[model samples]
Structures are given as structure tokens and as C-alpha cells.
Target: MYKSQIKIISVIIIALFGFILFSQDLEANSMPSLDYSIELQHDGSGIVTEKRQMHLTEGTEVYIVFDQLEGSEITDVFVSDYDEPFTYQENWDINASREAKTGKYSLIPTDEGYEISWGIGEYGDHEYTVRYTISGMVRQLKDGQSMLWRLFQGRNNLPPKKFSITVTGPKYFDPELTKIWGFGYDGEIYLEDGQLVSWSNQPLTGRNHITVYMQFLDQPFQPTLSWDQTLAEQNHQALENNSYQNEDDTTDIVAVILLCSFLGIGVLIVILASIYTAKRNKAIRAANPLITGIKRTEMNEGKVYREIPYSEGNILDVAYLLQEHGKGDMEAYFNAFLLKWLKEGYIVQLNTNEANGDKLKLTVQLLDSNTPELEQQFFDILLSAADRYGVVDTSDVTRWAEKNYDKITELKASLPYESKRTLIDRGYLYNEDVYFLGNFRAEVTKSSYQGEDLYNRLIQFENYLNELLSLDRVNLQQQNINEDIIIWASLYNLVEPFVEKFQEVEPAYFVTHHFNYSNIYLLSLYSSGFSSGYDQAVTSHQTSMGSGGTTSFGGGGGSFGGGGGGVR
Candidate 1:
């Protein structure tokens, strides 16, 4: 009888242990994603909305921290799961019952900043959308307007699997006069349709926070709080080691003009300028016509380059060059490679029953075409995600990427290296070792051409493609479209616009070209879907413990917010 009882107890213990292991495994595999949107008001306030889709294994609540918020007020805090609004609790209890904590939130003030906390309802998966208004978000500097803010805090265990931030400035915001820079992570931040959009190229982990600095040269705001320093001075000090400086520095230009004026040499300066302008025009006129034949506009001068820089550049080469210049990212590389393969007959997109307006999910089937040496690994990864029928879909790609996050990250990190090596071999780039006072040695990569002519040519190529979109149907049809151009368009995140333009001008273009899509919408869907899947996969199952590549002190210095919080 004793033996039988012990056997039953051991079986029960074994089953419980198995269950515990299973739960831990599930939680380990699942991850959360956050999407944040901030709209800046003319009054210098910002309305921030955080949409967090979380997978919770434990903890009854989660919270966000808003620290370093002196002179700033956090108000109108609201949290909901789209089903019902959470009631505001003046005093939030951390140890409350799941039933008691459900549909409740609290705003607690800390010595540093405010803590916005909400109940997690029951565990598993939950979508929590939190909204709050931050007063004094955009400050008025003595010389210009400035906004230095942190979107996410580093060292928070709850690192988002996939995250994106969309910051919409005032309607009258001018991209030309406003200079923006991003810090604290490896990502690309740029102005899109007058809005500043930023996203993580790789998964955010460890000390990788999100912070932005926007300097408005036109002084567009009338905020109550004022800073003593000029925005330019503050920007210079903040962006000491950061790389994403997109604006041209006019300090030297202004100084040179002032000195020439003070010296009463205006006529001499004008003659020199004219002579230089004449030479520039002569060089431009002597250049061969681009394949697109898009005429360069004045706006393209300095801001946009209208020609391909290198003679034997491919999509990967261009993607690498743009990335080195902070104008491209992993998303560009991912989309470009996928589309390039499809165009080269290595894969075929099959329409599925799924449809969303003009967009449709595409099932990709591997073709018998020989894959290029540079593309073989990526192709093999896609094949690994394929079903027994030798087909892969968007979902499959996402799943495979999630399961093989390290592989994808390593592959992406290798692309730039490979492209750079190719360029170096071609004499476009070379390494030069520099010594600091004849003691320490550092090898700095140098471009062969003066004033980054190769990079400018890429910009020109991009400008040409952009100009093509605005052309009339007749003019558009007169231009030739090729696989390389399409791949570069994907890198530029203009595939959708290009597809729309093609569809509007000549729907027959897709049928005639190597695009292999009967419906132009399907091509657009695949491009978007592939990008989305790749992002979702890379972000999943990534821990907050990263390799410590934090640049928090660089551009994000003196930024408001950036305290850390998680499930507690």
C-alpha cells in the first residue's frame, strides 16, 4: 500500500514539473510589440499614444516610466484594451487580485517623473493602448525651437519584439528648416510626408532606448519654458559622436559670407562664385544621360542626386552605400533582395484567397533558376521555411525568422560588410590608418572621390526615381523600367508608389515586364508583407540583454523621459 501511494505521488510530481516546463517554454517563445504615435501641437505639447501587444506569463500589471520630466506635466492619462476603458485608480495596489486589478489604471508621481501603470487583466496575450498628453514637450530655445525626448527606456526587461514610432509635428512644420537626429539604437529616422518616422532596424535589447532631437530653425513654437542655449549649439554638443546628422551645417557658409561682406570683397566673391557655377554647369552638361532620362530640377541640387554613382552597382551595392550614409536600413536590404529574386525568376508569387483592398497575401514558390552566389544563403533560408509543397508564405517567413533570429541578424550585418569589401576592391573605398600624436593607430575608411561624389550620385539616382513618379502617363510610358530600378525603388520604400504609378499609367506594364504579377496590387502586397514578416520575426524571442551598444550620451543627452519599467 505504501509503495503504491509513493508511485502515485511521483507520477503527480512528474506531471506538474512537465506542465511548469511547458509554461516556461511558451513564455520564452512569445514576445511583445509596441507601436507609439506622438502628435505635436502648436502650443508645444504632445499627445502620445502607445499601442502595446503583450504576451504575459506572469504579473498582474505593467507600467511605463516618464522620467527626467522637470517642468513637464503628464496629464489625461488613459488606458484601455479596446474592449472597455480602464477606470482610474487614485491608489493602485500592486498585489491586488486579477479580478480587482482588471479595468483599472493609476498615475503615480515619482521624484524623477510619472509612472503610468495599468492592470494586465488575465495573462496570455493582451493588447493595451495607453494615451497621455505631455505638456512642455517642445521647448523654446533662445535662438530656435527644440524637442529632445525619449520614446523608450533602456535596461527594461520587457523589450518590445517589434517597435515603431510615428511623430507628427504641427501642420506648418517645415522639413527644410527643421533638423532631426535619432540616437540610442541602430535604426533609420527620416521625414516622411512631413512626419518624422523611426523604427528599429534590429531588435531593441539591453541599453537600446529610443530618443530623438528635433531642432526647428524657424522658431515655430511659443512654449512657456525657455532654454538659454541656441538650438544649434545644443545640437552640436548633443550629437558629438552620433552619425545621423542629415542637415547641412551652414555655420561655415554664413561665416565666409559675413567675412567677405566685412572685407568689402562682395564683387570678388560674386565673380568667384560665378566662375564656380559656370564650371559646375559645364560638368553637369557634359555628363551622359541617365537611363531614366529624368531631367534634374533645382531642388535636386545638393539635396538630391539624379544619377547612378557607380558603373557596376547592383541593388545590394546601392543598399550598402545608402546605409553607410544613414539613408538606408535593414528593411531596405530585405525588401530589395526579395524583390530582386522574384524579378530574376528564382521565385514566383502565387495569389492567395486572402485579400485586403488591393493587397493580397502571396505564396512564394521556388523556381529552378540558379541562385546567385550572394543570394544563395537567403534563398536557402526561404526554402527552409517552405512547406512540403515547396512553397512559403508571409506567415512562414515570419515564423522562420522568429525561430532563427540570430541567423537573420548575422546575415543582415554581413551584407554591409560584403558590399563595402566589394567597393574597396573596386577602388571606390580604401582604408587609411591615422595616428593620434604618433601613439595610437586607427584605420579610417576613406572614399576615393572628393565630397562623397559616389554617395551624391546615389542620391541623384534616388532623385531620378522619385521624379519618375510625378510624370504624366505619356511621359511615364516613354521611360524604361527595369529589374535593377525596381529593386532600388524597394530599397527606397517607394515600391507601393511605383506600383500605383505604373497601374495608373499602364496596367499592361506588369504583364509585359518580368514582374510576373497579373495584378499590380499583388506585387505591392508582397513587398509590404515581406517587410512586415521580416520585422515581426526578427523581433520575437529577443531578450532585453543586448551586446551593450548604447549611445545614450551622444544625441539623447539632456532628453526628457527615459526611466525604465516592466511587469511588476
Candidate 2:
């Protein structure tokens, strides 16, 4: 009887061990996979609707990752627009659940990078795109959005994040008809039917919630360092102690040889020689003019020699020349460089991998698309810089560019576009082209409002300029050849009485002309798609209450982003 009982116990124990090993292997090789295909349809302008649902019974709302979907556009063909907007069209407004109810961003948190979504479409197919142009490499929804976020621990360390969440279509999605999309990240996922409702426990690197998200692991969440040095040191100490306790007292033969090598005369001589040579080369390179940048390139290369015009006092000219030459002085921009470039048309690179511990690449191109001429200019510059120092494909130029671009872009966050734009209007970019530029500059003393409140009161002044630009638009509609007469009059501070005629036709608040310069607001917004959301994404940074009651927001608010907020 005793022998029979022992045999039964042994079989049970073996089965349990086998089952444990199988489960361990299964866990080591699995992750959640998404299964929907994306579709983009055009025409059939009757109207279209987009609906989103939250499936978790306890959860009130959910967030979708955006920015990754660059190059794609969304359109609200026609939706029911109630008295109040139903869909949160602007990204700035937080998502509010009508049912359970609470306003919160579609993206609450994330281990890294935001997961944003928007109802995108073509403006007759021309409303610029932000998509997966760099899908696998250098993550960013588009230009301004960063894919550079990092986490300290494993994935799922933080909650999900979102940016530019849009739900356009007032008449149709005015109040939004809701539905549940899927269960929360914690619901059980049944692979057999593919109907799994499981919470996404994937903590991204850099967050501390990995322990809470990953439930099945018997061990604690590992530190995000990928390899924790402190823990490693502790483990190594324990190992050494154990080895000491179980070993022979004498040192091993291999250890003796390594010890002698650490103090050997021959090794010491080699170390000294290498250090001396490195220092000598460093000194020589510093004094050599050929190693500097532009001047050196001109002396060595013979294919082309176009000297950039430089300016003396103005900083704008210096910035423009540095960007063009591909190799030159790199410290001449304040918020001035980037703001000017973005408004006109330029894209700067901020990727770290491309920034070889150097400057940034401030690439300026048309916002519409890349032209062949532009491509040639870029490649030519890139190739020239590489050749100048035998950095040939070492990625030195691009590295410098990416860092420089990133710094300027971040700087733009604090600058106002008014002063920046005016500087360009008067022709400051040419100052540096002369000595730096071909000699670009405009007298600030002769500029509007002088430098007293150049930045603080720029938007209002810009409004005036826009109105002047509007005079040109009238020439487009009515062959009024006297267009220059009206424009010149406005520039010289004499258009007050001339603009009163436009008050009756514009929206109530937009009327009632104030200063000699501001009627430019409406004209500017109309051309730039700034006044309203009907045709284009108009941005006005300053919140204003004008004649009838126009509440203007985002008026060139000093180098702000397009994916900043919702438009009216």
C-alpha cells in the first residue's frame, strides 16, 4: 500500500513541474496585437460621420494615440450642429463624458509619447498632413510633435497620453452618438475567438507603475535602466563573498598575470605615447585655418564659390547666412531665426540620432511640398559639408543641423511672431549675407512703432497690415487698378476714414475700426485661413473683443503650433 501511494505522489509532482515550465515559455513570447486596417476614402461628399466608443463598464472615457497618423487627413462631410458644439473639434478642450460625465483629455497619461487622434480629411485635399512618414525610425506625429520621449522602466510604466484630439462636424456630430469600442486594458483576452477585452499592461520606459500593470510576474518590476548598475554591483558582491567562502586561499594563476600587466613598464610606456600624440594633434588642428568652416571650404573646393552676404549689427542676416553656407559661425540666433523661417516655409530637424553631438539642421522648405530645386539645394549643402572635413558621410553636418534646429524650435516657443515677421518684412535676413548675408538689414528705427513695444503690440499692428493686404484682394475681385493707391495710404498711417466703408459688411464685432493699423486683422485671417474654421485652420493667439464681439484667439501667438487647439 505504501509503495502504491508513493508512485501516485511522484506522478502528480512531475505533471505540476511540467505545467510550470510550459507557462513560463508562453509568457516569455506574447504581447497584444491590433487587427484593424486603415482606410482613406475621397469624394461622395454627401456627408460622413466618425463614432468612438468606450467598452469598459467601469471606465467613463478613453483616449486614442494620434501624431503617429501623419500624412492622413479627416473631414466631417456634414453633421448636425446644435446650438452648442457636440464634438470637441479643438484639441485644447478636454474630453467630457456626457453619460458618467467629467472633462478630461482624451490622453490622461503615458509611459512616453502621446497617443492622439483627430477626424482628418483633405481641404479639397490641401489641408497639410501629419502621418507616419518616419514610422519605424525617429517617432513624431509630424514636425513639431516629438517622438523623443523616453521612460525609465519597461513599457507601460505610465498611463497613455494623447495630443490633437479632434471630433469635427457640428450639425451631424453636434452632440456625438456614443458607442463602446472595446473593453479596458485589463479585460481577459481569449485568443481562440480573438474577442479579448484585456487592459493594456504595457508600461513604457521611464515610469514607476510597471509593478502595478504587470501582474503575472513573480518577480518585482525590473528597473528601467535595462541593466540596473546598483543591483548588479550588489549581486557581484554577493557572488564574490560566496566564492571566497567556498574557495582555496591561494590566488589563481590568471589573476597573477593580470595583476602584473596592470603595473607593467611596457604598458605604462604605451599609454604615455598615445596621450602625447593625441594632445599634439589637438593643438595643431586648433591653429589651422583650413579646419574652421566656410573660408576653408572656399580655399579647398573649386566647383562653386557663392559668398553669403553678411550684415554687421542686425542678427537676422547672420542667421540666414549660417543656414545657407552649410559650414560657418553657429551662434547668431535668438528667437529671431526659427520664427521667421516657420512663417515663410521651413522644417528643422530635431532627431538626436541625426545630431552627432553637434548643432541642429534648420531645413527651410515650402509648407506645400518638397520641390526638386529645394532637394538639390539640400543635398548639395549636405554633400559639401561632408567633403569639407573628410566627415564624408560621417553624418557630421546633419548632426549639427538637427541639434541646431531643435534648439531654435524650442526657442520659438517663447517668441512673438509679430516682431519676428516685421524684421523679415523690412529685409533683415540680408544683413549677414552682406558680410554674413549679401548684406541684409532694415532700420529698426524706421520700423513700425519703433522698438518700444515691438513685441507686445505686434498682433494689433499685424491686423493693420492684413487690411492693407486685403486691398490687394479687392483688385482680385474687382479690376480696381487703384490698388496701390489704397495700400500706400494705409502703410503711411492714413487709412482710418478709408476702412469705415468695410464695417457694415463684416461681422458685427469685426467692425468699428480703432487705430490706423488694426483693420488688417480680418484681411490677414482670411488669406491665411485664420479668421474661421470653414475653409482652413485659422490661428489668432491674442484673445480680443472687437467692434461687434469677435473673440480672437491664437493670433500669431509667438511661434505657436498648429496642432495647438480647436478652431471656431
- Note the Cα lDDT for every prediction shown: 0.66, 0.26
Distance (Å) between predicted and true CA of 344, model 2?
27
Could you say which candidate leads in TM-score? Answer: 1
lDDT of 1: 0.66
lDDT (10s digit) by residue, model 1, range 462-557: 778888888998998888777567777766777668877887787788776777444334445444554565564432222111111122323566
Runs in model 2 deviating more than 4 A are 1-483, 489-497, 501-568
Q: Give the Cα-based TM-score of candidate 1 against the true structure.
A: 0.43
Weakest 10 consecutive residues, lDDT, candidate 2? 208-217
Could you tell me every candidate's TM-score relative to the true structure? Answer: 0.43, 0.17
Per-candidate count of clashing residue pairs (backbone under 3 Å): 5, 110
Estimate, for each residue in 170-223, the C-alpha lDDT of model 2 and write its tens digit.
122111111011111222211112111122333211111111000111111121
